[model samples]
Target: MSVPTVDLLALCTTIKAWGRELGFAELRITDVDLQHAESGLQAWLDAGHHGQMDYMAAHGLKRARPNELVPGTLRVISARMDYLPRDTATDWRARETARLADPAAAVISVYARGRDYHKVLRARLQQLADRIAAEIGEFGYRVFTDSAPVMEVELGNRAGLGWRGKHTLLLSREAGSMFFLGELFIDLPLPVDAPVSTHCGACTACIDICPTQAILGPYRLDARRCISYLTIELKGSIPLELRALIGNRIYGCDDCQTVCPWNKFAQRAVLPDFDARHGLGSADLVTLFGWTEAQFDQIMAGSPIRRIGHERWLRNVAVGLGNALRAAPSEALVAALQTRIDHPSALVREHVLWALAEATERS
Candidate 1:
């Protein structure tokens, strides 16, 4: 059976409209010519900046060649979905900064406080692709939302969703960096949107404010030292040197995004999926540390944090408890550490023992 021909330009216009109807804040199309990003990606990989994320190096340069990854791909549609919760307060930034100051608070990154973005964006991207197929019969396309080897930021930058900020995240003057990105690689010869000029200017707030100095310079990030990577990506014991620097950020860190001046323009999620769950926005370290494996599993269901599993979840909360102990000794905090000190997993026990030691050293 042959696919019917359609007006590509008009179809592009209709696709964008459909995307808006489906909750995507903006959608733009760009040809799959990521040749410009290959070298920088190679340099980042060569420097071992990706840490234990071996998957980043697994695909080699296929990551920069979308057509190679998805053969016959002619155009890529990049979509952005703002994730700041719909009811986010105007003083949300100030509140986040204060939470970091309260040593007993468990600071999960804002994004992970809600449902997993991977599930949300992948489903929506597929819906958009289905809508396109309905308009022009069948089309060759694949939907991706951080699950593949594709260079999402590069594709998004080229698609004019936003320019890459100094922190190396795609930033928009209109919507800032508080959003998720997804790509629809399709065979359609849709007109491509022009790349937008970067607006970072002389601002270095994101780099200067990093707790672990992960942002080495303007755009360089050393993930091994990053609090987010240390708390979430690393499987073994958190490094002794970087453990204290991890502070109370148990799951992920949002310091770079929180301080980025562009985030003031960050829009709220039009969809409810991104809203905080289980009071995670204001959870206490001691309370979170007390959750049994079953409780953690039950509470964190449908959350991005669940991917880390109960053991790593215990590992992270122990680190936060350790940092909290160092800040101010609490019998409750020390007691929580004691309960986990005999945990079956050596990984959890090691972090728990270290946390208990924090209280002793503080005294």
Candidate 2:
């Protein structure tokens, strides 16, 4: 159904206003065309850079073609939500690096330390879409947050949300890259926003700082070597060669964002949903190590950490513990691995054995 010409501009205006009310910091609309990103995506998939993320390749060109994926999708309404906790310690990155240096400290990614964003973002996007339906009557639209084959970052850039940074993350002059992106694909013909100019301009801080050199070059990242993909996405044994490079990052890595100059301007989420939960912001490894499978489920019930499951969580923490043991032998660190020495999960047991050996070698 053709949208009335008179309602086009009004629809965009109302959407942006309602988005702010829903606690999204920024909103922009983009056309369904993503031909430009298609080639790059194909190349990345062809090179097997996505590792075991078969879904990325499975989507094919549907990821770039919005209307094809969602019938009648004429435009994409892109939104960004800032996630930095307002009260996060001043030297957060420094503290994380120090934790890597120390063997006993367990380092969880800053983003996963809080509630899961999938539920938070998906709910908000649905609310935003629902409100739009109220204003414009029932419409054909679908809300997505890190779901399916959506080219979220490309849409964000096309809608003028921000430029894709050298680290392959969306970065905004106003809010940096410490944010989550969601999309609302609608059949209405909304005016698309022009993309902003990139500002990386000779800065390679993220590339130089990546512990695994995941950033192969500006605007290119090999997910196979990324710590985040390694710890959370990859389900098999932690590659021994890259295990040492994983450092103390157990859940995910934010070093690229933490080191980016633009993130200094990253804003805090207007909604408290994104705030740190359960003191995960500064949790001790041994303390996290002691959590039983039941405790892990209970504490991480509504958090993103739960998606990795107890076994993978233990596997990652074991890698961190091994690295820590190598750096500074500690009875406490060894003991933590010992407790899990006979874990039923082979994944966890293998990592624990490796960590114990590392501690013994250090001693």
Candidate 3:
């Protein structure tokens, strides 16, 4: 079961080359030792910073112990894929900021605007695995994007893909934080890469710009207060205290990344799969809230936003529409909220009522 030293080195080199051909921006290998991250993870969990993501606590230390998760795993191949749409304008940051200021805009995070990264990265990673099998004989391996108990950022950090930024995202000097990470947990003992030095310096831009101040400090995030978690992860009531801070963001929040200076170098996707679909990049809250449940399912068929299901989608849009009504008293926004005020899902009904009240209070 042992590979020759020279052959292992050659295989590692070839694997990286194949990864590039498959659209990964960069690929590096790392050993399965995440012992250094275990304490921080435990402390975060103990503080309940993971919010309602019970799955984060479900796997316990197996998240850091890759070998335990997949027995016989020796090395993990961490791959990065930049997700900025290929047609991204040079002033995309300024444009995003403007969208946030426009109360009527529905600011879906840049990442979720296209096809689901889980599907895109998982398929590409599996294809890379298949290629590895074709190169070597049958190899034991499992591929993962964000769908498992794996600590992807830590793995990517250890693999020399990037250092962990203050926002807790893996950041590269070349590609920044606007990228998706996937991994290949394989039995191959490929030569491990060196970890990169941290480059965040004294920058606190990400923390300062968070709408919900979810970041407690550098590298410490309270997911319970995070706008992304509130909209995408939290399943119950949107915390009343934080709803106003949610602004018009209907999906994941990107304030942290948008403000990071490193993202000035964020790369664009080589694959068309990451391109914006259905005018999501420029959509208004009123327009998005007007979509029928059937229309939402059909339009969001291949997108990651669909996973939230139509109920939560409506709930998020209701919050956005409410925020818009408070900011500008838009009749269109109020009318949209009324259409769903009687929706069957109580979650949708509650949010719609709150949205209507937001406008009424302004009167």
User: CA lDDT, every prediction?
Assistant: 0.91, 0.87, 0.93
Model 1, 147-188: lDDT tens digits are 989899999999999998878899999988999999999988
Q: Candidate 2 residues 19-128, lDDT tens each?
A: 89988998999999899989999999999999999999886999999999998999999999988876767676677677666666677777777778889888989998
- Write down the TM-score of every candidate: 0.98, 0.97, 0.98
Q: How many backbone clashes can be found in candidate 2?
A: 1
Evaluated at residue 79, the lDDT of candidate 2 is: 94
Residue clash pairs of candidate 2: 103-324
Best-fitting candidate, scored by lDDT: 3
Tens digits of per-residue lDDT, candidate 3, 1-363, equal: 555334888888898899999999999999999999999999999999998999999999999999999999999999999999999999999999999999989999999999999999999999999988877778889999999999999999999999999999999999989999999999988889999999999999999999898999999999999988998899999999999999999999999999999999999999999999999999988888888889999999999999898899999999999989999997788888889988999999999999999999989
Q: Which stretches of candidate 1 lie over 4 Å from their true place?
A: 1-4
- For model 3 the local lDDT of residue 206 reads 94
